[model samples]
Target: MRPYLFLFLLGIVLFFATCRKKDTTPTPSTPVVPGCTSLLAPANGGFVTTTSVTLSWNAVSTASSYDVYLGTTPSPTTLVGNAVSGTTHTVSIPATPNVTYYWYVVPRNTTGPASGCASGARSFTYIVISMPVSLGYHVVGYFPSYRSLADVPDIKFRMTNVVVYAFYQVNSAGSLLAPGSATAPLAAVATKARSNNAKILLGINDGSGDGKTNFKNMAASPQGRTNFIRDIMNVVRTNQLDGVDMDWEFPTTSDGTDVTFTSLMQELADSLHRDGRYYLSCAITAGKYAGGIRDAIRNELFPIVDFFNIMAYDDFSTTTPYRHHSDYALASLCLNYWINTRGMPAAKAVLGIPAYGRPSGITQSNTVLSYRNILSQGGNAQLDSAIVSAGTFTNYTIYYNGQYTVKRKAKLSKDIAAGVMFWEKWQDATDGQSLLKAACDTVGRSY
Candidate 1:
């Protein structure tokens, strides 16, 4: 009995010692952060022109938090937010026009940086966001379909005037065809314009063909011209389009094509005005060298079309050898030529501003760069300020209009022209530095 008791006591003592000893074996290490998938927003190569942007991503399985990097740099180093517990982040950046930003998610676990999920990077360019105010002036914004259909809420109340470009394009055969990829939200655009008391028009341009030849051929006889008119009316009625904008590039050349173009304009204006609700406008050549657009302004085009949109950028063709393309000097010279020299009515002129850029040595049409592209590639906004002050930036030869330049152009338009028109809204910065917004802020500020 004593031996059995001793054995039991020894077993009890061993059990107590085992329980008291610290367990040194480590528990499983924290799991690594899983790779992120399904990125959204800005739609990959998406561009925006606005004051604020929202960034979003899908959830990572093992991530406890996320780190967002955003900046103009290709690899953004600016930490937008660190250890963000959620998946969405909204950033309110400067309104500096034509800026592009790169961003990505670095999802992490509790462990450390090495445990972060390697999500890839994405980019978005800020184009013009909104035109804040209009002073009863014609602020014609050409909304291009190269990008997404811009939500009309962004500009309807402010710009109050938009052209959904481009509905029909002229083929080499001199036939009018639907500009399939370039047409934007027509119904929505009409709805917004009606609601905001804005005027929305549809644009027709010479597309990918000999526009001069097409115009000449179509106008040589009444059949081709009448068919074109018929199509225009059909589209205008079906879409509830308030008007039509004829973008016949360089129809007023020294060639006889100018005569035919004039006739086409006459017929189009007559047909559209027959309804009274439809207005007929045209985009024509600038006064001098607007790059490839050297078509001399003719005194004849004025009475036919309701207004003229001068293609105002790409002044690099000046013999002075100055690097500036869309500078104050060129705009001044063009305005003088159109209104003062050509004897165009100030009420019928719409100053045209380019939303694209021509880098040094790029002269061809394909060589053009959108303002967003220039900004995405580190265009100098500081230089833009110099340009606004009637100065020039010599460091780089890239040609574009910034926030300041755009505003000044608008003021100039207000002084001499009845309205201001842009080649495109897509090309302007979608946010704070937007050229269109600059025009809106400057044109009506005094009023």
Candidate 2:
């Protein structure tokens, strides 16, 4: 072989090798495409409730902007939720409860989405409920609006439902008075609640002032029932209320009361339904017969109510030897009566627990005690399961639910009842230590 020819070929080979090396090591300033977009916030399999969901991602070094996509299917086909110039953007979408959605992001350069920047989609449900698969349980809390709406903001986040208490008076002419202690405008309360994905309920109490006899008169006649129903519908619609919680304590006390009560309930439910999905609930005595509920229930009037809240607490009777007023056994008895004897749907039965406990051996009947008072009385908050019902019982007279018992009851509700409810929200401890927090967490953990 000619030396000059071999050297020429070797030079050509070396030149080609050098060109390949330069091709492999591209210039840094040339700007490579943005990396794949990574989703943040709603993480993977997260849940959202509001119509507006804030989506965020780590901004790619070369990305000048981003385009988001969302839809009901697993692989979203919609586009351009926002032209996010930064790492985050809150996208507005019509979110429905108990519905799941899919979303993804695309990092883009000035030219368009950089090469290989299409991201994997993630899914999230609009609701964060942990109710059982077979059954749906609601966590209902009573917020006495008269107390103060300060807790509304925080309580709304921790609850699935809220009831504003004391729509106090129902006059004899079948008139509806604006119940007392509204402290804050009912509309504001309703708006704040809906914003947090929680339900707002209006509770009517008929035991005080003209609330008693006047209510009895209003409840005794057909005209009274009709007039009251019209008035209630007005109030509910005017305030954009989620529902009405009837607290007619003794609708069955009089022989004729049952007839009017049943008719009133049926008509009210029909009216609310006609207006679109409005809920109606009740605060009734645990006693089936003595409480005047057996007749009301036997008449099949309860079909109108979304659920019946059995006031399982206040076991205090005419006589007492320091009995467990809110005993687990007593609650069970009440639950069994509604579920077993009366043939009530477990989904429509809500077991009510008192936030406060009674005084040990307070020989007086109907002497009320609040959970806050019990705590102030040096009641050691311990979860005791020794009783027939699993709950936290501290002090001989105090039978309130601690975090453990509350969680247990929440779990039990999934099986035996529609859900467990508290008399009031203000009575529990605060932060994660609060009973409300415990109840919410338990539902999250189980569901």
Candidate 3:
């Protein structure tokens, strides 16, 4: 009985000893891969105007390095960076305009790359930096009273040789109408123009209601013309402006005002030139089809005015297949009509371009949109037309002079015209994609 007891006790002790040895043995653990990182900069679906873009991501604790993929497609296969130790990488993309690019970053460790990182990919649209165009050409920009004065940048003043404030109303009595609430705005712009050494002018157009009729009646009478010249001079003097820009939409032969239009301009020119400091310019029609109205800007008045802002964009030729209100062909024809056909001096012809775009279809709901708005709505800066989707149901195409067209026109103007003029300065994009900038660049003017 005693021997059996000893053997049982030994067996129990050995069983306990074996259990303790097994518990003391160590077991290898599985390694942890890096967690997914968040993307930063050039936010998803954003626009970048520069050639080089910096891509960055949030750092992960376990990440040993990062792998970068970038390409034109959604699932970017091109690996730009392999095992990059940093959290950011700058890649030089193509300088092409309006190109969409996609990119993603994968955090990696010795264990492996972070899973589900492909879903974190992002996209951006690239807009090429606008290049400089030409030198020794004038750039004229019109500023309407309705536009905010704050919209006009200091750089714009530097770009323009002449800036016209449009417009002060003209009453039937031939007296100048004040711009009312626009006084402060005008004063602000004037100060900016003076500081930038730019010539500023006050624009005159017919008043509201029977304004056209009043303008015609006033111009027909000698007394009315005399009053107009005197009142306009007084206003120009009060404003300390460089000169006046006359925007008589059209003086038709049917109304018998076409003849009076020349006489009025001639008289006004005489008064302005007598001062010796003030300059004179007139905004004339494109002369494509407005019969006597088009013919109204005769050769007799060409020598009187300092220059003619050939309103060359509103009317398109009948031969065009597309409804491009202002196209390269129209610009050429208008220049020809003014310089060659009308016998006006090439130096006196300033080609006019629109800073706004019209819809491709004549019946489109939105008649016009500013060039800035066009680009904001996904309009390509390189192309002349954009297919815009306004809402879920509204989709239309807008036609305007993109950077390419603007550069081309500016080059053409340098060849034959004095300079280029846009309708309103505020309508222009205030960036690298600005049509005004594109024109200035193409003409070799520094802004």
Candidate 4:
């Protein structure tokens, strides 16, 4: 009831109100420590193979050990494993194919009874391939002439599982014949092959020779074209051959032949498929020119044939010992380009490896040799590299130092499709060690 007492009460009330305001305002929380020092493996946002992914990370500072966890939801995670005083740790994840998984790491400091939780979680995804396998091979076939037809049964029987065989010819001069009417035996041999439960492909390719021009004529002219198709189909029907393989040396518009060659191939594919029989295949040239043409083929025939065999070996020749056709780099490069960029499916592509080498004096210019012959000339290791069976040619290209080299064409076979097909069977070693065998093993092919 007195002014002094009333004023004193008001002051007390004002002071209490100020204190309440300060207490009501929230205080900032300590910045939560980050999860782990660092992470790896299915690296940050990485794509990985296999259902179990290994999650790893560096241990946090002042931490004596680490613990890892993963889950589909946030926090209160499922622990994967714990490591002691280590900078890094790996945790195996059990996940289904094509599913994304989230994981995190926690650091444990000896000072505390419990380990500290990670600041956040890291995530990864997994992909599962049905079967990841490949095939490889050396020379496919070899026949001096029609006289070699008698050897067809022997060759096919001997190389029971050979998927492809190259046919060769000898001109009137008795020299190795390039593509011509002289190589007609191919059609008959292919027929015999089919009857024997084997597949045969004629060798109609000639690298770095005028034979390319002859090939263009054969593909362009109606008569030559019909003969070519007839020879192949006849072999298919009579010998029961599985397919026809075109081995034109190379097709380039530089000489106005690229378009024609492509047209020929498309026409043949259409014709062959219409019959509802015979597999159509081809050995596309390797390197820039080969690569360019293959890109065109993929656009034209990705859905046409059984597979496209790219001759990846011999980027260079014996003349350039440092560079040659069997160069692994070129082989891998062509494979990646076609499969990854050219829109060709991995299963529909085959990488060609040489069974032989070029003589040393030969230049980067295309030259081929037989693997069997190269083996006798100190190329044993090289030949062995290809993992072949009998009835496959060893195209012998001479290296500069007389140390002949063979291409280990098998490496890619197990990872790619269709398998390796070669140029000639006669050029192969008769000792039962041939490229066909190697390829069969790699791709799990039988017969």
Best by TM-score: 3
TM-scores, each model vs. reference: 0.61, 0.61, 0.66, 0.51
lDDT of 4 by residue, 317-360 (tens): 44443344455556677777777767777766776655565543
| Candidate 2 per-residue lDDT over residues 299-382, each given as its tens digit | 375455678888887665545564666666776788888888777878788878767555444444343455545545554455
Candidate 2 segments exceeding 4 Å error? 1-135, 151-157, 207-212, 288-293, 317-319, 363-369, 383-399, 445-447
The CA lDDT of each predicted structure is: 0.69, 0.66, 0.81, 0.54
lDDT of 3: 0.81
RMSD of every candidate to native, in Å, equals 26.2, 22.5, 27.4, 19.2
TM for candidate 2 is 0.61
lDDT of 2 at 435: 66
Clashing pairs in 3: 132-441, 133-441, 133-442, 133-444, 134-442, 134-443, 134-444, 135-443, 135-444
Q: Write the per-residue lDDT of candidate 1 for residues 309-427, one digit (tens) a residue.
A: 77777656523434767777877887888888778888888888887766444344455667766677677542451211112333335567887777788899898787778877667
Judged by lDDT, which candidate is best?
A: 3
Off by over 4 Å in 4: 1-188, 202-209, 215-240, 288-298, 317-319, 360-369, 382-408
Task: Give the winner by TM-score: 1 or 3.
Answer: 3
Candidate order, lDDT descending = 3, 1, 2, 4
User: 393 in model 1: Cα distance from truth in Å?
Assistant: 20
Clashes of 2: 2
